[model samples]
Target: MASPPPHALIIPYPAQGHVIPLMELAHAMVDRGFIVTFVNSEFNHARVVAAMSPSSSPGNNGVGGLDRIRLVAVPDGMEPGEDRNNLVRLTILMTEFMAPAVEELIHRSGEEDGEEKITCMVTDYNVGTWAVDVARRTGIRSAAVWPASAAVMATLLSFNKLIEDDIIDAEHGSAMGKETFKLSPEMPEMQSAHLAWNCVGDHDQQATLFKYLVKGVLAVDQCEFFICNSFHAAEPGAFSLFPKLLPIGPLLTGERGGDKAVGHLWQPEDAECISWLDAQPEPGSVVYVAFGSFTMFDRRQFQELALGLELCGRPFLWVVRPDIGYGKVHDYPDGFLDRVVGESGGTGRGKLVSWAPQQRVLAHPSVGCFVSHCGWNSTMEGVRNGVPFLAWPYFADQFVNQVYISDVWKVGLKAVKDEEAGVITKEHIADRVEVLMGDAGIRERVEELKKAAHESIQDGGSSHGNFDKFVEAMKQA
Candidate 1:
């Protein structure tokens, strides 16, 4: 009889953004005949299962090649009703507690028979090296997966080096009296004050997160392979700087084979938004706006946004999470919803859903420009589809991504906020949308990038070759 397929354990940091890409990676692995143990925190596992289509069972089985992926849940070391949004707390709980839980899992998995014994572990890089330690203690191979842009990982990896050079504050990794700077001349420039960790919380919180970031740097020394969800053509400077970062992604579901990706972490309102997109005008007519899972805004900012969309006088699709304002209710400007939704169905003005199947929405023909919070997956999707962007960076590595989208790629424009109100005004939004949609040069540039993204994933192309190499390495394990 033929040998059974290799078993691989995959774990992601417990956040919607982090889980989704790794789930894509899991799908990619299953496509290659690897049976996977897909791990989620107890909290997220429930959320993921709940969000899945009704026919999908909670664990152990899936459709298509996904049948090989077994869903497993471990506690996040967080209690029910605790704040999962606290980055520093999550990091501490994950590193200190999750390591032991995963170690126990590895041991039990090895006790299995035949090829069902796990050959390897692939974990989110942001989880620090604790997951790596689990693999080490259990005597199997492990690979660190960076779900964000290669540029962001480069920044994280370079934090200590920047500290040693005194280019940034050693204690905090912030800029030394500068607004923005690049790690190297050829790379994109980023705000020093907006260092990824600095965007999360106050001084104490920033310091705590930075400490874990330092541990993440140490993770590089302990981990085996460092895989990134980016393509070489997408960020040549980042690949050139960090040769160790294997570029096997921009891993869209359309590019992969198998069941739909396993991580939604929320119910996807795909039917409504997609049907709405179909009814819209021709290519490049509708504006697509989403701030991703975590970007939140206050009442004033929300009203300003609604008013801005109305003022654009263009068709739009907006995804608004229920808890977007963190349990606080928001009231739109007078007649805002009536204007958009009432006329939207008839004239293709506006459609709002709590959550959307983002990849499918971006792939739609009518999506002309993206008004985004600059999350890497959304950034990659927009780039892949050749859509222009109005970059609205909220925090963390998103600021750096905005730089790449606007300054480096030249395919998007940044939505500059008012200094006085500290919010992007309605007029600013409407005007930027008009400029972005009307810019011939921006459209042409994004078209070229879209072609690059396409070519890289084809046979013997850069990404294809890299994925083949990674698969081969796993086979060796």
Candidate 2:
């Protein structure tokens, strides 16, 4: 038999945003004739399969075309029914739990009677370190896939320097929440406030997470290659900072042409959000709001945001996960939802749901603006769809992403914060929303950015060409 095309193993951290991009990359590899095996945590496998069954119609037919792509679930060191408190703890578990499982999988996959001898492995940057010893033991090549913008990666690479300069530290009195510090000069016009807040905590747990992040990057440097889910033209200055990083994305572009064939790692409920948008009078007339899969706001912040949206007097689709904050069903300001619906004249102008189809919503003609947490995936999706943003970044490099969205691209506007408390007020939210959606000059600038984002991913475009080159490299390797 002709030697089975080089077998490759693809592993992604289990969260929603992380899983989706890795799935896209795996699909790309499969299309290029690689024998791919996608590994997931045992807990996540159950969730994904449950989400994929036909009964789960809204889900992307979980594992539909995955026949060629073997699915493997390894233990993540958590006992069944572990709490999974929050993003921070879960991330640490991902690193600590993944190493042995990956090593075991490699050995099993390379057996003489196995489906194929593993030749290469690709994993997310967060989990890349776990694959290092495994790849070395199995004599297979490995690459790190950074699912964020190059700017974020550049900031991460400079963490050691930030620590050394005494700008941030693990000491009890370290300069964390202070406004005086600034990001390294090496970073592109970024401020200290934009750094991932987790990196600044004084506690050991937080400090350890930063240490682990640094170690992960160093381990990635030892890998054969590095990949980022970004287009060259979108952040040329940032891309140039990393000599080994490859910008190969806008991966959601193909799906933009109204193709429903693209797989959704998280199957969303098909609510009437789209139908509501369809009834709107003009294209690009609605505001789309979602704070990704893991963000949460305090009750006061949530109430203010609700008031702001109502004050804007615009049609909107909002996703509010049940467990968004403090692990309880969020209670919006009393009578707030009723008032917004009343103001819209009951044409279903505001569709609030636990979750909605995000990519589809962004691509819809009625979505003129996006209010987002500035997570990298959501940011790319908004840019690709040509929708401007109202940035309300939560933790992580989301703050830096806001700088890119507002200061660099000038397509989006930031919410004004209280000068003393730094909390964004509802009035500030309302004012910025009006400026982005109503001002002629602001609209024109946003449209121009839309054009640039589109050009960056077209054929012969920076992202497209890089994708082609990436496949060629994988094949040659």
Top-scoring candidate (lDDT): 1
Cα-based TM-score, every candidate: 0.94, 0.88
Q: For model 2, how does the per-residue alpha-carbon lDDT over 288-355 read when each residue is reduced to its tens digit? A: 88888667787777787877888878888777776636224336778776667554534546767666
Q: Which candidate is the best by TM-score?
A: 1
Model 1 over residues 1-477: C-alpha lDDT tens digits? 977677888999999888888888888887898888888888998887777665566653552234556888888888889989887788788876678888888778756554377888898988856887778778887788888889988888788777766657888665676676678877987777777888887888888887777787787567677888889988898888889898987788322343254577766655678888888758779999998888888888888888898899989998878774532333767776666777454343878877777888888899999999999888998998899999998878898899889988899999998999889999999999999989999999999999988888888789889888887787675
lDDT per model, in order?
Answer: 0.81, 0.72
**Cand. 1 TM to true fold:** 0.94
Between which residue pairs do clashes occur in model 1? none
Off by over 4 Å in 1: 63-65, 110-115, 253-261, 324-330, 343-348
Per-candidate clashes, comma-separated:
0, 0
